[model samples]
Target: MNSNKKIIITAIDQRSTVAIVFQTITIGLIMIGSAVGNIGILLAIYKTKSLQNKTSIFVANLAVADLLAGLLIMPFMFICSIIGDWPFEDASCNLTGTFALILGAAGMNTLGAIAYERYCAIVHSMVYHLKITNRLILIVITFIWLEGLVLSLCPILGWSEYIYYTNEYLCTVNWAHDVSFTYTIMVVMYFLPLGVMIFCYASIFKVARRHLRQLAMLDTLSPPSSHNQIVSDSDTQPRIENSARSLRLKRDIKAASMLFIVIGTFVLCWTLHGCTMMCLALGDTCPVDFPEYVYTMTTWIAMFNSVCNVWIYGMMNRQFRDAFRSLCCIACLRSSNTQVIQI
Candidate 1:
């Protein structure tokens, strides 16, 4: 009996050890991947003049939020996962939690902002060109950051509270601290933004489809013999207007399609975390035995949003891919020059 008991205890310890190892590996990948992808996005945008536009401005804001999560919060979350304790002092803990929350709220909102920008740029290009200025976008971005600040500081200022959730190995806003406040945050900070993203993307898709149908009609009407026809025949004004509109419509479709991919990825990554948080908010207090690692894994899954945005940018946007390739080419050339100098 004694020998059997010893064997079972050893098996349990080994299982626990394996679990921790797996958790560490998972969190490490998320942390490293988020950092690398986000930094690359920033660098690629900075080096490419074509990408330095209004759409990219919103993306840059989102990147800043992800960069903060990777650089500041993720490492600590990883450390806590490994050690199973909040080793830092109370102040650092509170401040870090607040910072993460604010950035996260800001980042998520930035996605909505991007969606809105795309909707305006593509669905109403003429209006967008006339009314949307760099100064206006800058003001909007400032508002986003300010909104995040207010949401994050609310907890610190006693509207709600944030504390370490050991199960997830990160400090987050207290789910049950002030039930009403938690519900408010979940709705205002998360749901509304998600809805806006969905609506904007859906509207963009509708517009794109309508445009495609129009092009198909145009293709049917166009004659093969007119392939070399001049864009402006005798009515120069109407022809020029139509030509410009066609060009703007095509640009809008491409831009909107790219951002739609990004918003889809965001929805996928965030859904799991949102559902879990929703359960907590709704008072799901069943005492059923659940795997201890599940919550932490869910949180890790959310961290992947930071990682996926970069890949989405690379995959969905031609300009982004070209920018990345050019940046890599420059780096390679620099390395070769250094090698030649050494030789």
Candidate 2:
């Protein structure tokens, strides 16, 4: 064979192998993590009637968006990666691609809303009316979805251009490599929400610390056991203290801790991918050998954040942990019953 033919064969062989491996790893991780997390959250809410409060409702909304993103986007991406181009017909392409983009955008926005809500619950508890009506939450959720739809559908409507990186065949907002577009999106999607999250969570932590300090102070001030004390007042104070402590722990876990982890993971994964795209657009001459693979991997990493959120919840929130344990027990019972029948 000629040298040209030999090099051509070698390149195709290499690219094909890399594509297969990347697709498999991305698909496996996203699918298993998302499915398990979604099931756990759903079962947790259903079994624990108490978990259906305002906070869990917001979480449920976020989970629904992430669940859809995982189920729709990752499979579509996996097929595209393996086929080396758009696999769907033009109509299917438009629908699937648009749906994926919309849900992905909505997921981010929902996370921002959750962050803001947590901020309010922690920092401004006196003003927080748990009377957040169903109508209000529904309106908020609908607005979030609509905002995402508008942004994602702009290219389809000709307000923007949809371009795929030739190397990876993944589509995104090309914006003609303009920093303006990238910066605008970064602000809208990342910077603004991240700022809100950081500020709110910091406030939450401060509030918790202050509350704890006050409790410790009161404990110290209370008279010794020998002192005459109103029995009911004494009993009530301990109950109040215990309840306050429980709340501080819960808020600290959900708002001040777990939420930061989610934001951190998201910023880490998407920021790199976004910066690389910006660099390539600005004529940085990205290395061709593995740029696409790196980009694809990082993109999946961002998506994986969605998958990990439920586990974060399970780890941080007592209610989520209890719900997850219950789910596992139920699964174990079903498996044992199946074996008994087979016997």
Candidate 3:
């Protein structure tokens, strides 16, 4: 084994056996949780007839991308953790690293799509129905995956390669001290998406507030003689408007809020990883041992985005939540019927 790999084994071996057990349990939990969440979203979307709307279609695509992340990346990470150094040969290492990076980028871009869609639905409600065609939504989804594919291929196409520091027991893209690359990635991957999401969400909040004010105005305004019937008519419109507006606002708020929180978590988790790479590129000696541990934890935190996105879908959207519940209930019913018949 390499010297650096020896150090990692020594360090991790120094920990109490209990610590290893706890770490194992945590990894297992994350794997299982991610599996259930992803599978639930896919099944629910496919089975629920009413959920065939444009918004749900996009959400289902997001769920599928996230599912790939959880299934493809998480297991590779777990294997790396159990064994110090890359267990696989060079080709496998490159493939694993590329898959993780691509799926992760795709998942992030999908969140951008969700944010933009919500922006139109809430901020430009009148025109949203007219302008947001099924074809347009398909184009957006296509663009997101394509962008991710191109980015993930950059490193493989002689731009960069996997660097296994052995000391880190992780595989990540090579970090060059090139300021231009650093700035470009930070802008493209982090800053641009973050900025767009924030802007759209801010607009969503403003529109929702205006919608509420409109409802209040309708409630306060009254009519003249023969006013009773007019008042009823006025009341009917506002009530319907308020109910629809409120549902939309609530859904948008939850979805946007969830994305913000998850993306923020991604930023926090990956910041140290990015910083360490930048420092390495600049030829600065890093506090490697500690930062490696921190980066590993952050990678898990970023992985949390995949697992959490499904829960967000279930929580924020009523149809998704209901469909998931119904699916579970039906599964149980089938199992029970099988048992009774067997008896």
Which candidate wins on TM-score? 1
Off by over 4 Å in 3: 1-16, 165-169, 177-179, 223-291
lDDT of 1 at 65: 89
Instruction: Give the C-alpha lDDT of model 2.
Output: 0.67
- Best-matching candidate per lDDT: 1
Can you write out model 1's per-residue Cα lDDT over 78-172, one digit (the tens) per residue?
A: 88768766777777777887888888888888888888888887677669966668998889889888887888888788886777776777777
User: What lDDT score belongs to each candidate, Candidate 1 first?
Assistant: 0.75, 0.67, 0.67
Stretches off by above 4 angstroms in model 1 are 1-15, 226-253, 284-290
C-alpha TM-score for every candidate: 0.85, 0.82, 0.83
TM-score of 2: 0.82
Clashes of each: 0, 0, 1
Note the residue pairs that clash in candidate 3. 177-281
The alpha-carbon deviation from the true structure for residue 11 of candidate 3, after best TM-score superposition, in angstroms, is 10
Q: Is candidate 1 or candidate 3 better by lDDT?
A: 1
Residue-level lDDT tens digits of model 2 in 1-343? 1211111101332466765776767676787788678767877887898798877877888788878877776676666666655545444555564665677667777777787777777777667665355777788899878877887776577654455443443455654435565566667776776787777777877877787776677666653444575557776687677667767766565567777786787678668766665555555464543445676666677777777777766667887888788888999999999999999
